[model samples]
Target: MRQPSSSAPPPAESLDAVQAALGAEHAAIWVYGLVSAFLPEQFEAPVGEGTTAHRARRDTTERLLADAGQTPRPPEPAYVAPQPVTDQASALAVLVVAESDTAVAWRAVLERTDDKALRTSALEALTGAAVRATRWRRAAGETPAARAFPGQPA
Candidate 1:
């Protein structure tokens, strides 16, 4: 009976979690691109920025997988968006939800890992998500929401 090796399972990323989170990140990257279709002309810059940020995180996640000697799973063909983003209003709503979900996913990673760098990255992602959510809410003609914020606390 052979025993399992003690390689520390790479450094961070609960593969189970990474599978789900990676899917989320991938979806977010895709959603950000589509969201622009529904955004107002005034929102192009901000939404573009958010899209770029998501793209950066997507790239970083890929690097994490490579460093761990694991190939990240491909994202599902599609994800169930919260609702149809047919206009600026719905686009903002979708953006908020996307950021919030991303934050939640990163928080789960934080719980599943002890790597300081990963922890820091998770915090960064979470904080960015919270900020984006607030911005999205404001963009959608709403007031700033509560302070609970999404994802793990700093």
Candidate 2:
């Protein structure tokens, strides 16, 4: 993500939105870790990929906030999954929910920011989360795996 051009701080609304996105990224990393045990060995690659992607996004968000002189919010100790994740199917379902939440958060950032670089970064984050959610939905045998309007409320 690009740093703010001037020393002046980012807009308060934009900072808050980015902080929310950071929180979502934190929750996503936690979800990926929690689902590892429930997923089969064949699913290792995607799980690892998701974890890495979320971590990178999280780091970038933190740097952006810090550069703007705002302290980024820390992750919660634990997050409650939308559904219980006892088996492979439930695990995938929860992963879909996590990714969807991140997409929504990133989309909010896009709406709040007018900064060109910030908007570009937010769009990429939203798109990535949407794609990840679709993958999880497909793995769980969801009939319509792709959302018609990702980042929009269902």
lDDT (10s digit) by residue, model 1, range 1-154: 4333534454444655655567678888878887888766888898888888887888888777766667887777767777987887777788878887888888888788876777788778778877888888876777656347577544
RMSD of each: 4.1, 2.9
Task: Please give the lDDT score at residue 117 for candidate 2.
Answer: 90
What is the number of backbone collisions in each predicted candidate, taken in the order shown? 0, 0
Off-target runs (Cα >4 Å) in candidate 1 are 1-13, 152-154
The most accurate candidate by lDDT is: 2
Give per-residue CA lDDT, model 2, range 76-101, as digits (tens): 98789888889998999899989999
Reference-based TM-score, model 2: 0.94
Q: Which ten residues in a row have the lowest lDDT in candidate 1?
A: 1-10
- Model 2, residue 131: what's the lDDT? 95
Model 2 stretches astray by more than 4 angstroms:
1-8
